[model samples]
Target: MLIDLHKATLLVIDVQDKLVPAMADPQGILARIRWLLQVATELGLPTVISEQYPKGLGATATALTDAAPQAIVVEKLQFSCVAAECLPESLLAHEQVVVCGMETHVCVLQTVLELLALGKEVFVVEDAVASRTPASREAGLRRMRDAGAQVVNREMVVFECLRGASHPRFRHISKTFLVGEQP
Candidate 1:
């Protein structure tokens, strides 16, 4: 089944102020992730954001921080979101999860695997997740795919959420993500 927007969430993991500028492709990753968040919001989907040790790593980026002011920010030390007591409460298991954000080999990969093991389907937006090195990012994606998680592009997710162009929120969500063509 495709990702139903009514039962989907956009999970932003560790896209923090300090961590972002250090990424190999900061602007590109952030742009795609922000697009994901915007489209999710436009479609009335829920969002869960995580901060990997905020006291040390700092807060989420200003743009993301403002994207959904109502979104809960989980300050976590664990690599997986379910491992964080307060965080899992937000996931709710209501539907599929579309994951993105930093440190592909660390928190993002770990969280995706854990979610999949829980029998929850996860879609990782490839270009939005990054690592300190290209090799690390590639390795992380390979491992996640092997674990049964679907690593797809941001546009694939946008269409799955849209389902059909006739949907009421189609144009709004589509334009927000800059989703060009359907697959």
Candidate 2:
């Protein structure tokens, strides 16, 4: 199913400062997430950021927080963000959730499952989520897909939201974000 921008919320899961360095392709993951955040902000989509155990794992990365200063940051010890009780009412009202974050096999996977179980249409940004090992990341993506989560990339989510080149934000988003990158 195509993601509806109007009914969608962006859920940025556990991309903490302390945990990022060890993740596979940290720079690439962060760049995709930052780009996603920029697009979400421009589109005025509500965003919820989940931090897993801040005291032990540290806060969300500065770059991510800076990218979307207005995003709601929710601290949680639960692997599944749903259990954190941190999702904002505005975001919870949305029917579709676009998720991007770290450790695909653990936090991200569990969160996607929970979101799906909640009857929300879940989309996992494959490129934006990562694990320390390629195997784990692949397994997580596979399992999420098997569990009915749509596995998508950053460009797919952006362009799908835009729908057409004639869209007002299309030119700006394409020129600024999609430039030098293939969808």
Candidate 3:
């Protein structure tokens, strides 16, 4: 099923400073997540950013926080955001969630599984998430997909959110954000 922008919230999980450096293609993942955050902000999607034990892992990267100043920041001790119960009511109310962030096999995977269990539609952005190794990254994606989450790319979410060229921001979004983006 296609993502419904109005019904969806953007969930950025554990893209913290210390944690980011340990992931594979750290810069690339950060760039994609940052790009998605910018698009989500422009499109007016409610965004939630989770920082897992920030004191130890460090806060959400400045680049991301700067990208979407309006994002609701949540601090969680649990691997799964749902288990931590720190998410704001506004974010939990959404029917769908577009997710990105670090450590695909751990935090990202646990959160996606729990979100799926809650019966919410979960879309995991592949290129926007990573692990220290390609094997673990692919494993996380496989597990999430097997558990009923739709694995997608950043542009898929963008197009689905915009729906089509008829969208008022289509021209601007395409030109500004999606210039050389590939599927």
Candidate 4:
């Protein structure tokens, strides 16, 4: 199924400063997420960011904060963001949710599951999320897929949201964010 850009919202889950270094390929994950956030901004999509527990986990990484300055940042102790009741009604109104963040096995996995249960067409950006162990990350991806979330990569989302090369922002987004990157 195609992700309808008009009905989509981006959910940036728990990419906290203290937690990022422990994840596999921290830099690469952050880069993809930043690129996704940039595309979301250019497309005028609303973004909701969640911090697992700022007091303990640290704030959202500076890179992400700079990338999505206008994103609604919610701090919560719940692993599943839905359970935190932090997502604004405006964001929840969107039928499609694209999730990207840290600890794929924990926060990302739970959030995707709950979003799916809520009837939202959820897409997890695989390359934009990571876990400290490859085993956990793979398991989380499998579980999310088994539970009904469409597992996608960042590039697929970017182009899908753009729809076609003829889109007005297509050239700009491609050049600025997707350059030298393979899908």
Highest TM-score: give the candidate number.
Answer: 3
Ranked by lDDT from best down, the candidates are: 3, 2, 4, 1
Q: lDDT for each of the candidates?
A: 0.81, 0.90, 0.92, 0.90
Query: For candidate 4, what is the total of clashing residue pairs?
Result: 0
Candidate 2 to truth, TM? 0.96
The digit string of per-residue lDDT tens for model 2 on 1-183 reads 888889899999999999999998888888889889988998777888999999999999999999899899999988888877777788878999999898899999998998899899999999899999999999999999999999999888988888899888988988888788732
Report backbone clashes per prediction.
0, 0, 0, 0
Return the TM-score for each candidate structure: 0.91, 0.96, 0.97, 0.96
Point out the higher-scoring one by lDDT: 1 or 4.
4
Residues forming the 10-long window of minimal summed lDDT in candidate 1: 174-183
Cα lDDT tens digits, model 4, 1-183, are 878799999999998999988988888888778878878988988999999989998999888889888899998999989988888998889999999897899999998999999999999988888999999999999999999999999888988999999999999988888788542
User: In order, what is each prediction's RMSD in angstroms?
Assistant: 2.6, 1.4, 1.3, 1.3
Best by lDDT: 3
Evaluate residue 77 in candidate 1 and report its C-alpha lDDT on the 0 to 100 scale.
86
Clashing pairs in 2: none
Candidate 2 lDDT at 100 equals 88
Residue 119 CA displacement from its true place in model 2, Å: 0.5
